[model samples]
Target: MKKLISLLLNRLTLVLLLILAQFIVLVWLINFFSNSWQNIQIALMVLSLLMVLYILTRNDNPEFKLAWVIPILAFPIFGGFFYLFFRAQNLNMKTRNHLYNVVKERQYILSQNIDYGLKGNYKKIETFLESDFWPSYKHTNSIFLPSGESKLKVLLEDLKKAEKFIFMEYFIITKSKMWDEILEVLIEKQKQGVEIRIMYDDFGSATKLPLGYYKKLRALGFKVISFNTLKVHLNFAMNYRDHRKIVVIDNKIGYTGGINIGDEYTNSTKTFGHWHDAAIKIEGDAVWTLTILFLENWRFSTKEKISYEDYYLDYKVEKPNGLYVPFGDLPLDKNHMAKDIYLSLISEANESIYISTPYLILDNEMVTALKLAAKSGIDVNIVIPGIPDKKMVYMVSESYVPELLLAGVKVYKYKPGFIHSKIIVVDRKVAMIGTSNLDYRSLYLHFENNIFLYDASSIIDMVDYFIETIADSVLITPQEMKKRNIFYRVIQTILRAFSPLL
Candidate 1:
């Protein structure tokens, strides 16, 4: 009973209920006036026509434009009003301006540490990344962890060596064996006068942690903040989330990838069948790039000014013979650089392109790019999970398989369990591993981060891991997809039509 009451009184739940109530009242008012007066009907029609014109002229994704147009055109009476109210309630110019200034200042500090001499093909990649202020480094040594258990062991060992500060930002942080062990070390480190700060997404950890958990951490002498707290009001800014998983230790070591702070990521908890994930541990000057990324978001979340040089490490290490570039993407940015990076890899592949993602809901541009790459006889392949965590999303993922197979792209599903790794390897020469999935939210609407490797030794290991993972997957053929029932096809079409919103 207490649990139910707590859930009912939750801030997120209350806000959702209030929005629903307003929607119901709006619908009733519209219907009553439309039936009793002609002037109301004419006004609604004119408002909807203006909205359609605005949507058509805006520079947005085609899929998203279609999703909004269909509903507004089909039901003009209520749709236009709803769209206006939703847009007007969430104007966050202050937050956006603050974040822009923080990024501009940090990027200037990071550009000063870039290494200029590039080898063969790395020169092209370096030039491309630098066009957007993402600098490439040559002093970082990267370790590729093929599984969550391996990553956890190495992370715990690295946390013991922190002397200055620890900065952690993740989408989700649950109270599980994984977090409990790490928390113990953090508490002990606090006693030694080490600075520790954490930031997490409120919506991502809504059900896992209590309402006042950040306060509890503050009481324990740790600086913590919840990103974008949920309140009882009408707001659309909640849709934008912090999805990047980053950890920086003393500005000397950094980690980023698909794994989160939970037992499910380690396969210790069986939410789905054998969970598979990956992470990258980088040690060297490249860590400074990730440190800047974290501090930018930290400043936005806490409204605190941080001196970039205070956390910067000036010592040198044995420089590795490769190029490592770490970059971040923001939803408000016009570039949409994550999708551009993936498209560049696809377009530049000479022999093969391999990708692994948990979800495969893609827009038309991505679909066309994949199809073209495969039709060029370039051995394009993708691996997704056979055991799903979200049924609707899995259906939408499967809906794209048939079209891809018809275009000569090969698709595989891991037979053992869920594969939560987000990776892309091109021609076994360039590779990326990070938090961005191959879906709309990751590509277009969330803050994401990834590391690009040019001639790094980890590329060999990543290729080998991809081959091993493919061996355990089941291939899907066009003929097999054709055998699905008609009703299933209809449902798939419906889901695909609305995938932009998903």
Candidate 2:
């Protein structure tokens, strides 16, 4: 009872603090404009009008559009200009040109060597690739690592064997014993002249890392770049973070997915016991794809154009018949690739749509699509975290479960710990594994990525793993939900109302 009160009070306090801060900031801006001899208020109103029009024409989301429009409407003089200076996605022409050139060069090489070999039995995936994503690169092997412990062991081994270079980028790299071990290896590799470049999101790791984390790494001969530094002035830019966990070693080995570099993922320490997560480490041609992703973000931060040719490797042996195209999903792009890929899989699913995510908040389209799939007799199973780090999000996710269950969807709560893996396997043929959560922020507001698999090997592996995971999960039946306390259900309903913001 005390814990609940504490949580509620903390939430209330946080809300009050935010409102106070916003009011003070707005007042200060208004006062400054009023006192200015330049008639800044009149100028800002005009700028804000232009900003609103630009946002209205470009962004289609009603929620986000309202978020911007409301502020500009309330405080026409300052809010509009403030948005123009910060909220705009207007990329500099030079940056756009650089991206175009890089993409063109990368695509040209991909065309010559790689072939999308979804020819015979993989026709469904082929249509998905071309129509949805314009996927042209192929003949890549993708392996799924179901257990976090298993993935961590293999990743450590791969890091040990890296000879030339190791490119590491993640949203979180804490100063734990796990990271200490990795740091030791990175330091040793740096001393040996192996090119090491580390990139991490500043805000994500801010509390966990010391002030001079990058400086320390640089001192050890490691090239480190901090993505989007922390400052109130840069808050708008900070929202669009590099949430990718990509590790490319010697341009031959690569790893990516939901797992970050921490003891929790390895199950060595139990913050939330039995941490469930997934990741993939790829060798051969796929590593090149990840290296490019790292280089693009690295260049954006450091302004150092690293050569893709240097990282590219030539495989002499006949590779496995798996087509892998690793693409980065950007907020700047009009098309939502991650959502589109999942939607395509859901649409083409004949038997089942299995998903496991920490966050289950969805837009109207996704909610409608899932309901339709469940009603059409397609087995749609969604596994969410039982013990969520954010209790409100957990409640919000649960609120949606009953409706899906009513429509023939099966929902499971991971009884062991937080289910952090974002995975989807469609009809045992298509698989999606990545850091993207099925939430508005990931799909629309933030940059995310996923690896789409076409082969039967990984799809079966992922499906089997999901099945085994359910053994430790509690199936949420409607009868059981009916027995829940009235107070608890009310909390869930209230939490779900704010699901869109989540």
lDDT winner: 1
lDDT of each: 0.85, 0.74
lDDT of 1 at 484: 86
Clashes of each: 0, 0
**Candidate 1 vs. truth: CA RMSD?**
2.1
In model 2, the worst 10-residue window by lDDT is 230-239
Deviating ranges (above 4 Å) for candidate 2: 1-25, 28-56, 66-139, 234-237, 316-321, 479-500
lDDT of 1 by residue, 1-502 (tens): 9889878876567767888897788678877776666888778778988888888898889898887788889999756765666533353788788878887897788778665655458466667788777888777788899998999999999998999999899999988999998999999889999899999988888767778899999998999988878754453545568899999999888999999889998989988898988999999888988999998888877779789889988645686756788999888777787788888888888899999999999988899999999999999989999899988899999999988998899999998899999999999989888999999878988889999887888888889888999899999988888898999989989888888778
* TM-score between candidate 1 and the true structure: 0.95
Clashing pairs in 2: none
